[model samples]
Target: MTIHAVIFDFGGVLFDWSPHHLYRKLISDDHERQWFLDNICTQAWNTEQDAGRSLAEGTRSLIEQHPQHEHLIQAYYDRWHEMLPGPLSDGVAILEALHQADVPLFGLTNWSAETFPYARANYPFLRCFRDIVVSGELKLIKPDAAIYHASLRQVRAHLPDIQPEEVVFIDDVAGNIEAAMALGWQGIHHVSAQRTAARLRELGVGF
Candidate 1:
């Protein structure tokens, strides 16, 4: 079937989102860094936070776990913008090109509800998408089939006749691309804007 829609993953695909940036800014001591990773980084608290849990509630829960690191938690939350960079203008240009071609565009991102607006504000091209499915809003995360299905549902709501194979999903994470492919969607593991543009052109998607 001919490709009709294109889905893009927000974080690593368009913007450079680095957890190490947050860790470096928040944890100076090596011991504290290890502790933070053990108690906070990969914990269920973070999972819940990414799954629509309120920031204040997540912060409070973290503080309760490590009273001594309350200030650290506050600082990290206060300056969350430091973890993200501007969108790749080249990628946005390609997306805009696709948009002009009447190829429906959507964003599938695993972002916290509390921080999504901030990221969106920083990246104006985010508004160009026809639909956006944020994991946090649905209390789901990527690599989970539910989230993929949810994204499909959102697209289906608008273009009800669209088929899964008719959509192309682009992401920097191989795991996410794999997940999308599992759902019978075409998946592109984005390396660079130039490569992506070339791939899109090869797919007969006009620049």
Candidate 2:
């Protein structure tokens, strides 16, 4: 099957998202800030929220384990928007270019449904995707075969002729790219916008 569409990841790819953005202000010491995120507010723990738990529940549960950092834990949800500085215009430009070329665009992201609204509300470009299967809403994250398959199934529903090999997946994480490739989709490991645009053209799938 010929490539028919491009799928993108939300954070790190289309937008600038980082906990350090929020923690930088809360913890002035760079090392201590890393320590806080590493030990106290770890990505593994946060993945639970991305797996569909509500912000209130995730925050309350963490506070129960580390009461001393309750204030900081709450701050994670309170100042969540601060973590997302803004969208990546370069990536947005690629998305627009593809959209203009009539290439179907889709999104598969590991974002908390609870916090996803902030992004959806702020990034109008997200409307470019024909569909976005959020991890929080699906309780499934990237590198998981289920989420990738779900995205394919959703796409197939709309474009019946589309096949697994007919999709090009763009993502920042190596693991996500590997997962998509394993499913037979062309994978672009997004390092920089310049490199990504070049890769797309090299694959003959560019706008």
Candidate 3:
């Protein structure tokens, strides 16, 4: 089927987000930075927040578990905006191009509900998506069938006739792309704007 809609992953795909950015500023020593990320605020630990644990709840829990990192734990949520450097210009360009072409746009992301408002307030391009399914709001993360299906359902609710094959899901994460592919939605492992444009062209989405 001809691709009808585009679903984008927010952080890695459109924006550059890494705790390292914030932590690098907070913890000058690389070793200590790495240690804090691994032991105190791990990817897994952050995922809990993404999976719907309130930032306040998550931070409180972590601080309780690691009293030594209380200040740092509080910093994760307090300084959350520091982690994002802003949207990747290349991806933003593609999103604008797609929007200009009138392609139906949607977002499926695994981001903390508490922190997402900061993005909505700061980034204008996020408004390009017709609708977005946030994992934190739904308590489901990507690579899970639930989030994928939820995204599709949201799209269909409006369009009412879009097929799974008619949706192209783009993300920087391989696992999320793989999951979309398994669901019969076309998946593009976005690396750069030129590459993503080439992939979109191959799929017959006119710029």
Question: What are the lDDT figures for the candidates, one per model?
Answer: 0.82, 0.90, 0.91
lDDT of 1 by residue, 37-90 (tens): 676645466667778888888888778877887787776567778877567677
Clashing pairs in 3: none
The number of residue pairs in model 2 that clash at the backbone is: 0
Superior by lDDT: candidate 2 or candidate 3:
3
Cα error, residue 15 of model 3, in Å, equals 0.7
TM-score of 1: 0.86
Q: Candidate 3 residues 58-145, lDDT tens each? A: 8888999999889888998899889998888888999999999999999999998888888999999988889989899999998899
User: Least accurate stretch of 10 residues (summed lDDT) in model 2?
Assistant: 1-10
* Number of the predicted model whose lDDT against the real structure is largest: 3
What 10-residue stretch in candidate 1 is worst by lDDT? 38-47
Considering lDDT, where higher is better, how would the candidates rank from best to worst?
3, 2, 1
lDDT by residue (tens digit), candidate 2, 1-207 = 467888999787789989999999999999999999999899988988998888899999999999999899999989999999998889989998999898899999999998898888988998888988899999898889999999998898779888888889999999999999998999999999999999888777858
Q: Which candidate order results from sorting by TM-score in descending order? A: 3, 2, 1
Using all chains and alpha carbons, the TM-scores for the candidates as numbered come to: 0.86, 0.97, 0.97
Off by over 4 Å in 2: none
